[model samples]
Target: MYGGVAAVKELSLIVCRGEFLTILGPSGSGKTTALMLLAGFISPTNGDILVGGKSVASVPSYRRDQGIVFQSYALFPHLSVRRNLEFPLEMRGVKAAERADRVANLLARVHLDNFGDRMPSQLSGGQQQRVALARALIADPPVLLLDEPLGALDRNLREQMQSEIKTLHKEFGITTVCVTHDQEEALTLSDRIIVMRGGAIEQIDTPEGLYDRPKSLFVANFLGEANLLNGVIPLPNDATPTSMLSIIRPERIRLAVPHAPTLADAHQRQQANGVVTEVIYAGALRKYNVQVGNNVLIMREHVASDQQVFRPGDQVRLDWLRSDVRLVATETNNGVE
Candidate 1:
């Protein structure tokens, strides 16, 4: 707790061996605080942290058997790339010859063998990030901690590094815990994602599961675009309780002219009519905001050569498979371990 307010409360999770787990949330959602707690940077007021079945909650950061890659890269500016990678091994009392060999192997592994003599400032942002990752892995620690590791790069570079990180994770098979607010990053890299809000876990599931079946309204909207069907439309089936709300993805909606011929599978689809209120032309997809009754429902479709495009004021019909709808709680629950 900080300043008498609980920064993270009743948070409990297990990081399986060789699993890539991501803690995802917006600012002040307690994700970073949780990472700090795991890294031994701060001791929890009540609770224990177990690594390899041993309690290490009170251990200092330096003594923990884990590697961390901070957002800043945190390379020593005065040292060469090779020396930076060697620092951890040196501190662990590795012999000079073994340290040199390990540094060389890691440099080559990160595609920086020829640049080992260069300083951190002399390298580009991507290259420096690679070096930081290499340094983190040089000691072969059992767990790896990443704190917004890709926040420093541009869009294209970040994509490239994401692939790189995924490949490295596959190769090393290390148990990794990453904390970030980027939904795309979490979805792309994690085997499982923990969505946190208001200092509590909103949900924990695989990326596909979380996006497809969020447990609460906050998670449904936060992870991706969700069209709340509550008060906007009637459910095709009445299986859901009144306390829950139905939601559908924007891409699950299909749009057509109001008088278009009925689809072949109309028997299994639910249909609605609305006037197009807005049309947004994204490069690869079309986004439409259609006003049905008093609600504006969003619909997305890939831009295809033979597809009909609707504009504002156009009458459109939206349809989706009856099974595409999902039910979620209207509010988040006070989570437990």
Candidate 2:
């Protein structure tokens, strides 16, 4: 077993150059450990990690030329922002003149151009984070690794920093690997997400691909809120067959009118009926908990300026495109409840 328990089993992953990839999973799913292995903080017992098409399993962390930003900011309290930014360059013996230019440029890039004289304790959490980011980038490493670098900020600051980080990545075109437990953050920031479980890779795909076509039930439930109903394959449609575990996203489900035509017909494809048990108004959208026979289904609809509202105990119908229904492999102990 790896990490004293089967943390990762035969896991292999590849991150393309200049691609922003986020590893997402619940706590103890080995997302951080996987990143640590790639960063040379830990070694994989059974698999190899490659960076830039070269095996990095044997490369020491310091010589790997990868920039890392951690959750703690990890700035030196005694040093000014400028000195902190220059520390990495100093270690590399970069001349004083070039280091000054690089640090000045990085300070501007991270939006701390005038804060160079400030100590870490004198800055706000967000500003300190920006300094940490600038310090990491001062050396201009080929790869960047961020381990929940935005976890300490408030909701507003976190969102702002998310955009800032993305902008910085685009500006530098650096290959970045981010490890995050926040599903929404992963979905928003990553060009692609690698979902992990039990220290193993579950699925790696673009956010749209993973959300629209989950390969397993674990991924379906992890990526977003899924209204999964256990139902037998009644029969294969003459057109296409479905597997045992199939799921549909809440947003894809729609409210249907009883008199609508069957879903098989082209004009009536977006129609199905269910009984509404609960209605939740969540500002931007309304969520309805509907029951179709023994299955409890969830439907989400955007709150329109002029829309009829439904209440609990209302007889409602659910509808969605057939193409939106995704078939997935069975999941074990998904812990979604």
Candidate 3:
């Protein structure tokens, strides 16, 4: 009903005290809307959202006692770092002496103690973001919400801040929910991740659960790169398990050398023979597009000091453990949309 789109539909979520949860999805996938609902910025069309076992359906945003850090640093440019950190305390009317003590502690916590006198414009992007985080935590709110707080920084700085934010969450033990479209960031920061799509909840699990055992095709493809093999389920054998569909990850697929030990001979016949079509060097890993009959499958492996190099237009045999090929429900159409 908001943003001219059905932002969230039939969404129910609960967060325990002091848990780090992340809402992750692509743009327009309703991640931010869900965050807004929890933060009391927008009301839900249906269903109730509870915080700490209490319903906050009609709670006003200001009274929610939640701290939020936005994608943009959203710092007051005219205010010095110290003033910015103290602004929340000032509004809350904490005693000046106590405010100073809290400010000093926070400055040390965020590693911005000496830069407190500088204005927002004077600090670099990373420093400004740290200040924003410090300001949000100033009030010691029950819950912390972050909306793509690292989106503006360069990649290197963004990675660094990710660790800092994670450390802060652990140190403060505050229940936190972060919204981001970045999968890697979500996997890095969240104890549990909620994957959303088309105003609906797709999957909610620990990072490894979402990646290793996705419930649906949408979840499999959205969380990471998956080589969805479009093949009918083979009957259960001594080696193969009976299922409807197979979901293979690129990194799980392996290449075999002719003279090397055979997986089938080793009682590991979970292998597929394919022809290599394209090779891509991705710095840390090598990606290969392999053609298995009419299906093009992806394979990935880490860069090795003495790695075997393969080029396009070479026939290669790909093998994997039967356990690695996850059996997923077969659908008539891929659920990408």
lDDT for each residue of candidate 3 in 254-316, tens digit (9 for 90 to 100): 886534576544565476677789999989989999888778888899999997888888767
TM-score of each: 0.96, 0.90, 0.92
Cα miss at 190, model 2 (Å)? 1.4
Error of 3 at 265 (Å): 7.4
Q: In candidate 1, list every pair of residues with a backbone clash.
A: none
Candidate 2 vs candidate 3, lDDT winner = 3
- TM-score, ranked from best to worst: 1, 3, 2
Please write out the lDDT profile of model 1 over residues 103-168, one tens digit for every residue: 999898889999999999999999999999999999999999999999999999999999999999
Least well predicted 10-residue stretch by lDDT in candidate 2:
232-241
- Candidate 3, residue 3: Cα displacement in angstroms equals 7.7
Cand. 3 TM to true fold: 0.92
Tell me how far the alpha carbon of residue 156 in candidate 1 is from the true structure, in angstroms, after superposition: 0.7
Residue 172 of model 1: what lDDT? 92
**Model 1, residue 144: C-alpha shift (Å):** 0.1
lDDT of each: 0.92, 0.83, 0.84
Separately for all candidates shown, the number of backbone clashes (residues 3 or more apart, or on different chains) is 0, 4, 0
Worst 10 residues of 3 by lDDT: 328-337
